[model samples]
Every structure is written in C-alpha cells, then in structure tokens.
Target chain A: MRIAFTSVGTNWDAQIDPRFGRTAFLVLFNEETAQLEAVDNSGVQADAHGAGTAMAQRIYELHPDVLITGNGPGDTASKALKNLHMRIYVEAHNMSLKEAYEKYKKQELTAL
Target chain B: MTNSGIFKLAIASGKGGTGKTLLSTNLADYLARKQAVLLADLDVEEPNDALFFHAENKVITPQYKMIPDWQSDRCTLCGDCTRQCKFHAVIRLGEFITVFNELCHSCYACSDLCPEQALPMKPYRMGETRHQILNGLQLIESRLDVGQEQAVPLIHATQKYICELESKPAIQILDCPPGTSCPVVAAVDGADLVLLVTEPTPFGLNDLKLAVETMRQIDKAFAVVINRQGMGDDAVENWCKSENITVAARIPYDRQLAEQYAAAKLAWCDNTALEEALEELALFIQQKQVQYA
Candidate 1:
C-alpha cells in the first residue's frame, strides 16, 4: 500500500501540510519498499486557476492507495480522486509524515 | 466621422462602483436621442444596466461554451487529452476520465489534440443574454450563470450577437466589468475608445494604474473620468495629468445623484449637474471618436 501525505518538506519527519491542493510537497510512502519519495507541488501552488485539480491529477498519476492531509480535497479534486477509488484521510494537520503514517497504521485518522 | 464603422465607446472602471453603469447607460440614452445607440452590458457576472431601463421586447437567449465531451468507449486509455489540458479540467482515472466543466477554459486544445478522438468538444450552457430595445437604444445584457466560472466566453458570445444585429448603429457604448482581467479584455476588445472611470481615493488610484497599464499594454486609446470628484483626494487627476492621459469629464459627488442611482433611476434625469456632465462626456467622446475615426 502506498500512502500519500501532503507535506511541507521532502523528508519523513516533515510536518504534514494542512492544505491538500496548495501543499508545497507531497511525500509518498510505499509499504512494500518502505521508502519515502517526495514530489514537488510548489508549481501548482502558484497556478492562477485549478491548482487543486492539478495537484489531484498529479496525485492520481502517482497511484497512491490513500491520501492524508489536513483538509479534504476540493470539489474538482474530489471528483478526480473518486475515479481512482482512493480514500483520503483528514485531520492530519500539525503532525509529521511519520506520525501520520503511524496513525494511519493504527486507524486513528478520519477518512475524508 | 466619415467612416461607416460604428464608434465603440467602452465605459470601464478600475474599481467597482466607480460609476461605470451610471456613466454608460446615461451616455447611451443621451446619445440615443440623435441616433440609434447600442448599449452592451458586458458585466456578465452581475449585470444591472437593464434595471434602470424601461425595456420593451426583451429577448433572452441561452449561451454556451465548448467543453470536452469524453467518450470512454473508444477506450485506449491514452492520456493525451489529460496531458494537453492546461486547465487540468480533464484527468485520466484508470478506465474513466473526469472533466470538470467549471475549470475548462474551452480552449479546444484537449479535444482537438486527442489522438483517440475520444474527447469531442461539446456546447455546455454557461450563461444567457438578454436583448431589449427601449427609448431608441438597443441594450444587450450578458449574464453568467450562478455557478459559471468563466466570464470571457459569454462576453464573446454576446459580442457575436451584437455583431450579427441588423442595425449598424453609428454609436455603441459598452459597460464593462470591473478590474483589468481577461474578462475586461474580452469586454473592451475591438472598442474604438475606452472611458476608464476611477474615483479620487488611493485604492482607486492604485487600481487605476493597473487599468491604465492594461490599456497601454493592449494599445487601446482610453481617457479617464473622475466620479465622485470631491469624495476623495485629487490623486487620480494628478496621476492622469502626469501620465498625459486626458481627464475627459468629472461627475461631482452629490447626495441627489446617489439617491437617484440607488433608487434605480437615471441619475442624469433629474440632476442638472449630472446631465451636463454626461452631455459633456458625450461631446468629448464624439471629438475623440472623430480623432480616432
């Protein structure tokens, strides 16, 4: 299972960003590989329109099984992610990627 | 003045409520006495120019903009359409593609460039236009649907309708939307001259600079109008003078004018000062039009 976390930095200890669409970085953790890979989302942050949709497209292309963020995806982004049947977990704000991953493992986070 | 082309005068504002509609509708009515005038309310989002008019024979037409109609059956799952859409309106989701109509710019890049020919462009209702003739003036009001995100497409459609009208009036007045955005560009595009209405406040001056920059960038001939002359400082007039832009006319701040405007009455109808101001503006535009034509 691959878990995507909206993060401020590229590392596992990076604090999970509250914003899903405008997050600066996305940290992906693959259970099979036990590896953390970061995707830069800063470009979408400055998009004049549909920044969330662009980030959602990127997330969908990444094929993450689950997403963790402070808030849920917006309307357009929600529609894009619904196609992948990927569930999004929210209320991960103010936590590190590792803490969010641990909470996800224990089923403590809320599903968006 | 000899040219057969209509003199298009667009009344726009750097800031909202800087008297764009107050100026345009009155100007159109003022000009309509002598010759037929076309008044286009290009403020698609919140059009209120028709409110003050006693319109007759109002005709409403639905407006549409093209968006990608995805045919999933031709399924090769090729991501060409997804990759080409700059707006991110289209995204591939395994067996299906999601197209957000709100985000679509209707640029036709995604549909035409699709290799599988699955994404075909189709008309999607975005807004409506109302055409009414009253007091020898033809009023065309374009209004965007509540949820519609883009205003430029509807403005273009309204302009197209205006172009196809039977009568080629010698004078056309456009009441444009606020700000110097793409919609504003679409509203004022191809206009012979533009009257940028701005007040004397610092916010008005700041946005006036932006509007002036946009006008200069687009190379459109424009003049400044000072609305509510005494309400704020004379910064706008000073800035226009420094930039060598013509201050066409100044409509003084008056309680009566505001009362008439708020009551949905033509402010120029009862106020002699406003009437003179609008007439002065009309004459100024006629001279400017002559210089341009």
Candidate 2:
C-alpha cells in the first residue's frame, strides 16, 4: 500500500508539516517495496483558493491508499478523498517523516 | 472609435473611505448643468452613489455570466475538464465529478476542452445594474450578489449597457471601487481620464503610491484629488510634486462637511468652497478632454 506523508522537506528526517494543502513536500512511502519518494507541493501553495482540493487531487493522482499528515484535510478535500475511498490519518505533529510513518505502521495515529 | 465622443472620467482610490463617492457624486451633480452626465457606480460590492441621489425613476437589469454545469448522464468521467481547469473549480473523485462555482473564473477552459462533452455553460446571475434618473443626472450602478465572487463581469455589463443607451451622455463618470485589484482595473481601464481621490495621511500616501503604480502600468492618464488636506503632513504633496503628477483639487478638513456626510446630505449643499472646487474639477476635466482630443 502507498502511504503519503505531508512533510516540511524532501528527506525522511524532515519534520512533518502541519498543513495538508500548503505543505512544502509530500513524502510517499511504498510499504511493499520499502522505497520513499518526495513530491514538491509549491503548486498547491500558490493556489488562490481550494488549495486543499488541489492538494487532494495531486495526492489522488499518485494513487495513494492512505494520507498521513499532522492536520486533517479541509471540508472540500475531505469529501473528495472520501469519494475516492482513501483513508486519511492525522498524527506526527513536530515529528520527522520517518517517525510519523513508524507511528502509522503501529496504528497509533488518529483516523480523520 | 477610440474616443467614443464621450468624456469618461474614473474616480479611483486604493484605500476605502477616502471620499471617492463624495467626489464622484458632487462632480456628476456639477457637470449635469453643462452637459448630459452619466454617473456609473462601478463599486458593485458596496455601491453608495445611488444613496446621494433622489432617483425619480429606476430600472434594474440582472447581469449573468456563463459557468460550467456538469452533465452526469454523458456516461464518461474522462477527467479532461478537471485537468484543464486552472482555477480548481472542477474536481473528479473516483466515479463523481463535482464543480465548485465559487472558485470558477468562467474561463471556460474546462468546458472547451471536455472530450466527453459533459460540461455545459450555464448563465449564472452575479449581480444587478440599476438605471436611475435623478433630477437631470443619469445614475447607472451595479450591486453584486451577497456571496458572488465575480465582479468584473457585472462592471463590463454596466459599461456595455451605457454604450447601448439610445442617447449617450456627454460625460460618463465612473465611481470605481477601492484598491488596485482586478475590479479597480476593470473600472479605471480605457477611461479618458482617471481621478485618484486620496487623503493626506501615512496609510493614504502608501496606498496612493500603489494606485499610482497601477495607473502608470496601465498607461492611463491620471491626476490626484486630495481630500482632508489639512489633516496630514506635506508628504503627499511633496511626493506628487516629485512624481510630476498634478494635484487637481484639495478639499479641506471641515467638521460640518463630516456631519452632513454622516447624515447622507450633500456637503456642497451648504458649503460654497467645496461646490466651487467640484465646478473647477469639472472645468479641468473639460480642458483635459479638449487637450486629449
């Protein structure tokens, strides 16, 4: 399963960004292959409106099964993700991306 | 065709409550005696020019814009519309595609590029323009819907309405909205002349600088009209002098004018000085019209 984590930087050591839509980077962790990748989120940051929805679309395009972030997605994005059958989890505030992914693996984060 | 044979003067200000409406209404009132005048309150968000006039007859016309309406029966969620929309107004979630009208800029990129032809353009009422006849002056103002985000369409509609008038007025005074945003640009652009009304305070000066930059960028001919002259320092005047922009008129700070304005009364009714200043402004515009012509 592909899990996405909103991060402050491109690396696994980078802190988890609290904002889902305006985060600097979205780090994708492939559980089956044990490979991690980062996608820059500057395009979503520059959006005038519906940043959450735009971010959700970007994530949906990646075919992520789960989204792990410090904060929950906005109303519009939540509706879109729910329709896409994607589960979202909120945790890892002030923690690194790796730490957040470990907590997600342990089922310690709150589902939103 | 460029001239339109009618003098178009736009009153603009970067900051709100800098006496733009006051100057516009008074100038319209003064100019009506010499020529047929049309006062177009382009500040659709908060139109207040109509408040100053005792309108005898009023006609309201609804303004509409084309927005994308999706058709689910078309049997395809190709995501063509979703990918084409730069505004993020359209979103495809699994089997469903949702359209957010509020974020839509009406660019029609989605509907135009839709391969499935599921998206169709529909007219959405954004605002209403009121054509009012007051004593001798004609008032054309637009009122935006409470939650509507699109204002430029209404403003353009008002301008088109004026052009289609049976008898075009000699002078069309556009009372523009505050700030140097898209709405303000729509109001002031293509005008024969733009009068930037500003106060003489720090906030006023800062915003005036921005307004001036906007006007210059658009290559529009503009002049400054300073309100409450004595309230602030000589910085504004000095800056204008340095910039080589003319200070066309200066309305002094007066308690009676403020009181009358608060009561929704014309300040020039009891004040001859203000009335004379407005008259001079009218003459100045006339001279500019001739000079530009």
Candidate 3:
C-alpha cells in the first residue's frame, strides 16, 4: 500500500510562514518497503484564491493510504484526504516524522 | 473628529506566535476602564483571546449557499461549468460530473453557467459565532465550523452584531488572525488604524514585511508593536526604520505577563510602562481618526 504525509498549518522546513501564501509539506511513503519520498508544495506562493484547497489538491494527487500532519483530523483537510482514501493522523508536539511513520506501521494511528 | 465613530484597530502580523492576541486583549482591558470598548476577536480558527477572558459565548450563526447535486439524466456534459470555473473545481468525465467542494469558492459560476436545468443550488450551514461580555466590554467572536472553507462570511456576520451598539465607542480593537489571508483582510478592511504586533526575530521580520506591504496596499494607517523585544536581535527595529513604519511600543519578555494571561487576568494596572504605551497608542489612533474625518 502507498502512504503519504502532508504538513499543513505550519511548514516545518521554512519554520516561518508569510501567512499570505500557501505552505505545506507533502510526503509519499510505501507501506511495502517503508521507503519515503516527500515534496514541498511548490505552487504555494502562487496561491491567491482557494489557497488551502490548492494545497489540498497537491496532497490528494499523491494518493496515499495514510497521512500524517499537524492539523487535526477534523479540519477541512479531512475532506481532501478522504478523496484520496487516505487515513489521517494528528502529529502532536515532540513526535518526530519518523516516529509518526513507525506508529502508523504498527497500527497505532487510527483512521479519522 | 470628536471621537464619535468606532475606532477600529486591527491587531495583526503575517506570521503566527507574534503575541497579537496578548497585546490586543490586554490593551482592550486597559482602555475599557475609562471608556466603553468592543473587543472583536476575529480569529475564527484557534481564537485564543477568549482564553484571556473566559467569557460565556452566546451563539451567532451565519448561512451560505452552494451548488446542489445535479441530476445526470438531463445533463448533456456540455462542459460549460468546467470551462467557466477559474478554480478548476468542477470536472466532467463522460456522463459523470464531480464537484470538489473544497476547491469551490461558492462563486455560483458553475450553477449560473450550467446549460442544463439539472443543476440545483442549496444552502450550506458554514459556521456560527459566539458573543460574550468580558468585564464591561462586549466581546464578540466567531468560530468557523471544522471543515468549513469560507471563514470570511462568518466574520462578516459577526460584525453585524457590533452595529447594534447603543453608542459608538472611542475605541474598538480587533484581534486579527495570524495571516495575510481573506480572514485577515476581513478583519482589517474597514479599520481606521492597525497595530501590528510582532516579535524581534528573523521570522518575525520576514513575516512583518509581508503584512506591512499588505497594509500599505490596502491604504490602511498602521504602526508596529514589538513583543518579546529583547529576546532576539534588533532586526525588527531596523526593519521598521527602513520600512518607515513607526515603532509605537515594545513589551519586554515577562514571565509574569504569561502567567497572568494563562490565568485569564488580562486586566493590567501595575505595569506603568505597558500602561503608558497602550494609552499613547489609543491617543495616536484617536488623533489619526480626527484627521481622516
């Protein structure tokens, strides 16, 4: 199964947000091999209207079975995640990305 | 020019964690002592100002309309809606048409441009607002329901409650959300003055410039307030100097202030410098409003 993780609300890479533009991290992981590949939403700066949805679309295209991020599972993000058939997991403070993935592998992260 | 109308001030920054709420709410309390004030917390998502007042929230509801499910039998898949959509939210595949609700801005273009009569429009309950009284101030705030894409519509609805005020106060401070998005724009749109609160750090300076540009573009009068001033270098001050935006005040890093805010004790009187800064800001805004009038 293919898995993906997208960061919204706050960008861990830039660490600072301009608030005007879109910023999110998109990661793709393979459940069969545990290999991970991720990409930043390059179209973030171009978001003028429907920015949140634009970021959501990029994540949806990844088509992952599992998703991990800072936003809660109950946000508007769930709608986009649901489109891709992806399970959602909320990343609390102090939990690293690798640890989050490990928890997903162990069936610790539940579907939203 | 005699302080007759409401003095709308926006507390905003382009970035989060800039202490905009602390400055807006605490300052509101300081001014409310001698004058009537209306504190509008416009930050729908994660509004933390109420954490400072812990006031009882009365519900405020707003309604919205969106595209209703269309019948496929009458639809010919002419792709009129798809081509008309700038957001690319609507797609037509053979006989099936799917609407990406998240991508749609509720523009009504799809429904209006639909050649077939199959398209139906319906109302979607987007979100609701909650009003409360803190101290002597009427604190009105709105909360966007989870999964709601449109936050500005609900914010606009919250402002309707403010018009019912018996007498327009000398000061009305709006605690804006942390961003330069539509929600932030709605908060600062009709404001006469804006108080931008930011920290003294690279991230703070980086985001402040963007927010400043936005304010300038909108032609709104604004000043700067530096929170946690001594934590980092003087980049914020230098940037302010270069940008020509006046630094109205600076609040040092104080553990006591944090404790006070956490305890819901936003009213402050013992801090002389803090009191002086807010009072000065209030006077400055009043003077600016006079010029505009």
Candidate 4:
C-alpha cells in the first residue's frame, strides 16, 4: 500500500522548491516495499486548486492506497483526491508524519 | 463637539500586495500618541498584523449558523435546495441531502424555498475574534478556523470588540481584509471614512477601481493612498484624478524603510519627513470630518 501526507513543509525532511512560493507540502509512502518519499508541491502549482492538482498528480505518480491530513475531509481539494481512487484519512489533531504511518498500522485512520 | 469621537477609519483594498496593513498600523501608532486608538484587523483568513507586531494575543470566539438543518423524516427529497443554490453547495440524491458547509454562502434561500420545511437553519460556531496588545496599542484581530469559509461572521464579531473600547479616539483605524466581497462589506459597513490603499501597478489600479465602485454602490465616504508611489507607472494617480476621488497620501519607494519593516522596526522612525506627512494626513481627516459636519 502507498500513502501520502499534506503538511506545512514539503515533508519531515523540510526540503522545498523555491520557484513558486513554498507554502505547503506533500509526502508519499509505500507499505509493500516500505518506501517513503516526500516532495514539495508548492512549486508544482499555484493556489488551492493547483494544490489539489499537485496532490492528484502525486497519487498518480505513487498510486497511493491512502492519503491523510489534519483536516480536509470534504473540501474541493480532497474531493479531487477521491477522483484518483485514493482513500482519505482526516486525523483528529496534529500528528507527526512518522506517526501517521503508525496510525495506519493501528487501523486508526479511516479508509475514505 | 457634534460627536467628534475620531470615527473608525477602515483602510481597505480589493487586491493583495496593497499597503493596507502597513498604512493602517502606522496610522494607528501615530494616532495613539494623541488619542486612545483601537486597530481592528478584520482579515481573519490571513491575519498578518500580529506577524508585523509580534505581541501577546487574546482570542474572541465567533458563532454563526448555516441554513437548511435537514429533518430526514420530513424531507421529501424534492431536491429544492440543490436546485436553488447558485453555489452548488447542496445535493440531494435518493433519500439523503448532503451539504458542503464550506461552499455554503448562508444566503438562506435554500431553507426558505423548501416545501415541507424539513430544512431548518442551525447555528454553528464559525471562528474566533482576538485582541493583542502590541507596543501599547490595542490590536483587535480575528482568526477564522483553518477550513471555515464563514469570514463575515468573524468580521462582524470583530466590530463588537471595536464597539467595546473604553474611550473612543479622534481616529479608529480599521485594517480591512483584501477583496470587495461580503467580508469587505461587513468590515466597511459603519465606517465614517475609508482610506483605500493602492499602488501604481496595473493590478493595483484595476482592483482599486473595483473597490471604489463598491464604496460608491454603498454610498460611503472614501479617499486613496498610493503606496510604493514611485515604482509603478503614473496611471494610478491619473485614474484617481479622472474619478474625482481625493489622493490623500503618497508614500515613496524606500528600500531602507522596507528593510526596517522586515527587521520588525518602525518604518517612520528614521524618516522624519514621512512622519510629518502622516501627521498632515491626520489633520486632513480632521478637516474632512468637520466639512461633512
């Protein structure tokens, strides 16, 4: 299974692309191969819609089975993610990027 | 004295990158020297005043409800709300009526048009209004919940805090949120004067005209302040001259002032000339209030 997380920075690594204003982040994870990769999506697009497109493209790129965030359950951006066959997990509060995978392991995250 | 209480002055612009915050804070700081000033930051979505002032903060909780609190038993599934909604915020399929709360404009048309009266509007908590004391000035601010789309409710709540001020000053400077939307209207509704901040760029000129038209439609008193004055073309001044709106103040481009601002220092501290200009603006607003009186 593959997963992704949206955070303030690009990922836990804190790397960001400087082209477009670096304001948001996207991280990808894999369960089968235990591979994790995180990339900055701020440079990929502009505005909220652009952020949605960037997430969709990441799903396409990683073919993630799950995606997670602190919020954004029914927002337009999250709806776009649903279009890509990616399940969404709206966490209750702030959890670290590493802890998200642990929550997934404990089945605390919702599939949708 | 005919209620010469320095009326709340809302400084707004229709677009981003305008000097709305810069001008508002400076004006408030300047007015504080003579009178007690309350600077309301109604732009809850992106409250940057604290970013500029970095002081202790207080929060004011905002509460607002949305329309169409659906009763599943009474709902006929006629899809009336989905049909009437201009924003496509509602959808009725089969036995369920789904609502995307963020997209809702709270127009109440959906609930009013429902036949069975199944849809009842419910009061929902939206965001919070906050106050921060920065450098001896009362900074009234509002922060909309990260995902909440109801900015108007918080903006209105911000006004309530402004009304609670112990002593009204000769001037109340309001740093309004960007854009000429519902939130902007709520911010500028009761202001006696509006100082529109703008620049000479094409984008600034374009949005300034939109803001001016909004003010005209609402029949409010207003003037323009050209910021970063010398960098952009002269079209901003020309547009003001053609529209017969007063160009109240012009702030020249000074990299040193910009650097000082970034370093969290006062912009007018080193520039005595700029300080004198802002004082003249205070005097100008005083005269305008008397003229209207």
Candidate 5:
C-alpha cells in the first residue's frame, strides 16, 4: 500500500506542509517494498480556483491508497477522493515526513 | 472645429461602489442632447446603467466562444490533449479525459494540438448583450451568466457589436468594472480618455494610484473625478494636486442624490449644480478631443 504525505521539501527530513493542495512536494512511501519517492507539486500553484481538486487528481494518478497531510482536503477534492475509495488522515503537522510515516506505520498518528 | 470622430470615454474605478455607473449614466445622458451617444456598460458582472434610463425595445444577443469538446468514441486514452493544455482544464482519469469548462480559457491549444483529432471546438455561451435605445441614447449592457468566470470575452463581444454599428455614435461612454484587473483593462483599452471615478478616502486613494499606474502603463490619457466629496478627507485632492493629475469634476455628498440614485431616478439632471458640473465635464471632454485631434 502506498501512503502519500504532503511535504514542504523533496527529502524525508522535510516538514509536512499544512496545505494539501499547495504543498511543495508529495512524498509517497510504499509499505510493502519499503520504497520512498518524492513528486514535485509546483504545478498546483498555477490553479486559481480548484487547486485542491487538481492536486487530488494528481494523487489519484499516483495510485496512493492513503493520504496523510496536516489539513483535510477541500470539499471538491474530498468528494473526488471518496469516489476513488481513498482514505485520508489529517494530523502530524510541522513534523518531518519520515517521522510522520513512521508514526503512521506504528498506528500512533490520529486518523481524521 | 467640428469633431466628427467618435470620442470613446471609459469611466473606471479601482474600488467598487465608487459611483462609476452614476457618473457614466449621467455623463452619457447629458452628452446625448448635443450629439449621439452610446453608453456601453462593460461591467458584465453586475451592470446597473440601464436602471437610470427607461430602456425600450431591448434586444438580447448571446455571446459565445469556441471551447474544446471531446469525443469519447475515438477509443484511445492517449493523453495528448491533457499534455497540450496549459490551463490544466483537461484531466485524464482511468482511460477517460474530463474537460472542466470553468477552467478552460478557450485558447484551443489542446484541440489544435490533439494527435488523434478527437477534440473538437464547440461554441460555449459566456454571456448576453442587451441593446436598448433610450430617448436619444443607445445603451449596450453586457451581462455575464452566473458561475461564469470569463468576463473579458463577453466585453469583447459587446465591443464588436458596437463596432459593427452602421452609424457609430459621436460619443461612447464605457462604464467599466472596478479594479485594475483584466476585465477593467479590456473595457478601458483603446479609449480616447479614461475618467477615473474615485472618492476622497484612503481606500479610494490607494486604488486610484493603482488605476493610474495601469492607465500610465497602457499609455492612455486619464483624469480624476472625485465623488461624495465632503464625506471623506482631502487625501484624494492632495494626491491629485501633488501628482499634477487633472481633477475633471467633483460631486458633493448630497442626501438627495443618494436617495434618487437608490430609487433609480435621474435626479442629477434636475439639480442645477449637478447639471452644470456634468455640462462642464462634457465641455472639458470636447476640449480634450480637439487637443488630442
């Protein structure tokens, strides 16, 4: 299962970005393969109205089973994710990407 | 010298509710007595210029723009149109490409660059133009449909309709939208002169500076008109004095004018002081036409 975390930077040590849509980087961690990858989310800045929805579309394209971020997705994005049967957890803000992922693995983080 | 050319004057205010429509309606009404006048309300979002006059024989024309419409039967999820769209309007989701009409700018870049020729351009109605003829004045008001974000295209369509007129009016007063956005620029562009309507407050002064900067960058001649003069401080007056920008006219804060305006009545024409001010404004515009000509 791939878990996506909204991150401020491309690395694992980077803090989790509070904004889901305008997050700088989306760090994807595969629990099965123990593999980690970071995808740049710079294009979301160009979206004026539906940034959250567009970012959700990008996340859907990545095939992430779960999304972890500081803030919940917007109304439109949340609806899209619901249709895709993706679970979202909102917590672990200001924490590093690696710490957030480890806490999620240990079932320590709150599911929102 | 008799000025035979059409004088296009655009009334714009950087801040909303600064009496742009009030000034434009009265100015057009006063100017129509001597020569033919066309009052084009380019504030497509919420146009209220028609309220001042008893507009008769109204004609509504729909404004459309060609937007990319997809054909699902092409049988290929190649993602060519998605790659070509710069606005992110096209989204590819599990062998299906969805087009968001609101996000599309009607640039046709994706349709033109489509590899399989699946995307076709279709006419999307943006807004409607209402043409009305008053006693001696012609009012062309553009109304953008609700939930529509694109206003510049509708403004352009209204201008095109005006240009196609067989007998072009001697004076065209465009009531522009507030702020120095794309819609304001579209309405004020190619005008003979821009009359910036502003109040005497801090917000009005700050927005006026922005409007002035936009006008200067576009290389258009502009003059300031201070409305509700006594309600606020003299910041606008002092700024205009220091900048050497011409103060074309001033309308004082009158309770009667406000009440009449709320009732959709032309009370300015009845008041001696307001009528004289509007006439002087028309005279000033005539002098400017001769000077620019």
Candidate 6:
C-alpha cells in the first residue's frame, strides 16, 4: 500500500505537519518497495482560499491507498475526497515520519 | 449642488460600527426629501439598513454569479480549466472534476478558455437585492445568502442593479462593508465621492488612516466624518488636518443619539445635535456634488 502523510520536511525524521491543507511537504511511502517520495506543497500554501480542496486534489492525483495527517482533511476537502478508495487516519501530529509509519504498522493510529 | 448627473456617494469605514450606516441612512433620508436618492446597503453579509426604516411593498430580486459546472463526457481530461483557474476553485483528479463555489471569483477565465466546452458557466445564486421606498428614499438592500463565502459578486450585482434602475439624476448613497478589502473595493469602486466615517479613538484613528489610504489608492475624492466627537482624543481630527483631508462633519457624543439608534430610530428627528451633524454632511454632499459634476 502507498501511504501518504503530510510532513514538515522531506526526510524520514522530519516532524509531521499538523495541517493537512497547508502542509509543507506531502511524503508518500510505498510499503512493499520501502521507497519514499516527497512532493512540495508550496502551491497549496500560496492558495488564498480552499487550501483544503487543493491539498485533497493533490493527494487524489498521487493515488495513495492511505492518508495519514493531523486533523485529517477539513469538511470541504473531505467531501471532495469522499469517493477516493483510501483510508484516512488522523491525530498523527508532532510525530516524525518514521515514528508515524512505525505507529501505523502497529495499528496505533486512529481512523477519521 | 448642480444636479447635472447622478452623484454616487459611498459611506465606508475601516472598523465595524463606526457609523457608516448611520451616516448613510440619515444622509439618504435627509436628502431624499429634496431630491431623488438611492440608498444601497452594500454590507451584504449583515444588512441592517432595513432595520432603521419601516419599508413597505418589498420587491426582491435574486442575484447570481456564474460558476463553472463540469461536463464529464465532453471533457477530454486536458486539465485546461484546472490549470487556468487562478482561484484554485476547479481541480481535476482522475475522472473527478471538482468545483468549490466558495473559492470561485466567477471570472469565467477557466470556462471561457476550456477547449472541449466541458466547463460551462452556470448561474449560482449568491444573494438577493431588495428594493423598497422608505419615506421617499429608494432603499436597495443587497443581502448575501447564508453559507456564501464570496461577497464581491453580490456587491457587484447590487451595483449593477442600482445602475440599471431608473432615476439616474439622484444622489446615490452606498453603505459599504467595513475594512479595506475586496468587498469594500467592489462596493466603493462605483462611487464618485466616498465618506469615510470614524471615531476619535486610537483604534478609530488607525483604521481611519487605512480607510483614507484606500480612498487615495482608488483615487476617489473622499472626506472624513468624526462620530462621537467628545469621547476620544483629538488624534483623528489632528491627523485629518495635517493630511489636509476635509472634516465634513463631526457628530458630537450624544447618549440620546445612541439610545435612539439602538431602538432602530433615526436620530434625525429626536436628537438635534445629531440632526445638525447630518445637516452638515448634507451640505458637504451638496458642495461635493457640484465639484464632482
């Protein structure tokens, strides 16, 4: 499964960005390949309004099977991503990317 | 004032409850007795001008702005509309093309540039413009529908409606939304003269400067009106004097005025102090009409 998480930086140790919409970097992890991909989200940050929807759109394009972020997506973004075949887990705030991934493996994260 | 053409006057403020509506309502009421007047409460988010008057024979017109609706079959998945939208209102991922109404500016840039004609502009109801005669004053109140985020479209629609209405040779007083933002710009952009109302407090002075700067930036001839003259320090008046901005009128601090205002009654009749201030504002408008004419 390709799991996507909002992160403050691209590295594995980088802390998770609590905000889903205006997150700094979107880090994608492929569990089988053990590979990581980071997409810069400056465009989402610069968006004057509807950053929630924009961030959701970006994640939709990535085709991630699971989304892990703090607070999950807001109402508007959640509605846009409603039909997506992905499990959204939230409350991973302040955790490093590696720690969050480890916690997800252990079924420690809660679903939104 | 020479009445060669319609004089569009706007009442604006940087802070909320600084007497923009007070000045607008009274000025429109006072002036309508002499000549034709159109009072537009352009504060669409919270329209309260109707509260001050017993308006009868209500006529409401629904206001709409165009928003792009996706036609999936016609779309080639070219991503043209998404790329062209500056507001990020439209986004396409896989087969789903989503349109966020709150983010749409209704510029038609995306819809017009779409090659496949997949995105067509559709009228989305944002607000309502109500017209009524309030003691001979032509009162037009534009109110945004609940959950509508963008107010500029409704304000523009109200302005357009006002323009299309008959009686062009009157003084049009627009009670604008507070703050120097997009909605304020849209509301005041149509006015020839703008009356920026403020108090004499520090907070009032701070916002007054911003309001004044906005007026200058827009290149609209504007003057200041000091409400609650005796309450705050003289910073506002001193600043206006130093800046060479006209002090059109200063409404003295009167508890009676406040009491009447709270009860939805015009201070024009009950409070002589407030009445005189409105008179001064009326005079200033008359003089400005000639200048603008």
Q: Tens digit of lDDT per residue, candidate 6, span B162-203?
A: 778866637788999999999999999868888899999999
lDDT by residue for model 1 (B1-293), tens:
32366888889877898999999888888888888999999999999999989876999999999988988787488788877877788877666788899999999998888888888889999999999988679999999999888999999999899888888688989999999999999999978888999999999999899999999999988999998989989888888889999999989989888888888887676888888888888889778877877
Interface RMSD of 5: 2.5
Ten contiguous residues with the weakest lDDT in model 2 chain B: B1-10
Per-prediction DockQ, in order?
Answer: 0.65, 0.48, 0.10, 0.03, 0.36, 0.70
Candidate 1 displacement at residue A46 in angstroms: 6.9
Q: What does candidate 6 score on TM?
A: 0.96
Compare candidates 1 and 4 on DockQ and give the better one: 1
Top TM-score: which candidate number?
A: 6
Ranking by DockQ: 6, 1, 2, 5, 3, 4
For model 5, the superposed segments whose C-alpha errors exceed 4 Å read A10-14, A43-54, A70-83, A89-112, B1-4
Better of 3 and 5 by lDDT: 5
By lDDT: ranked, best first: 1, 6, 2, 5, 4, 3
- Candidate 2, residues B27-116: lDDT per residue as tens digits? 888778777899999999999998888886899999888888989998388888877887788987666778877778889898888887
When only the first chain is scored, the TM-scores of the models are 0.95, 0.92, 0.64, 0.66, 0.91, 0.96
DockQ of 3: 0.10
Better of 1 and 3 by DockQ: 1
Candidate 5 residues B1-293, lDDT tens each? 12358789999988899999889988888888887899999999999999988866999999997788888897387887777676667767666677777778888888888877788989998889999987779999999999888888888889989988887787899999999989999999778899999999999999999999999999889999998889989999999999999999998888889898899987777777678779779889989888877
Q: Per-residue lDDT for A101 in model 2?
A: 81
- TM-scores of the models, in the given order? 0.95, 0.89, 0.69, 0.66, 0.89, 0.96
Q: Model 4, B1-293: lDDT tens per residue?
A: 22455576889997877878878877778877776777888888887776666665665556565656778998888877766766555655335666667766777988899898877888766777767765547877778877786788777767776676665555567889898988899999888888889989999999999999999999888999888889989999998998898988888887886787677665775777558758877887888777756
Q: How many steric overlaps are in each model, in order?
A: 0, 0, 1, 4, 0, 0
The collision pairs in model 5 are: none
Error of 4 at B172 (Å): 2.2
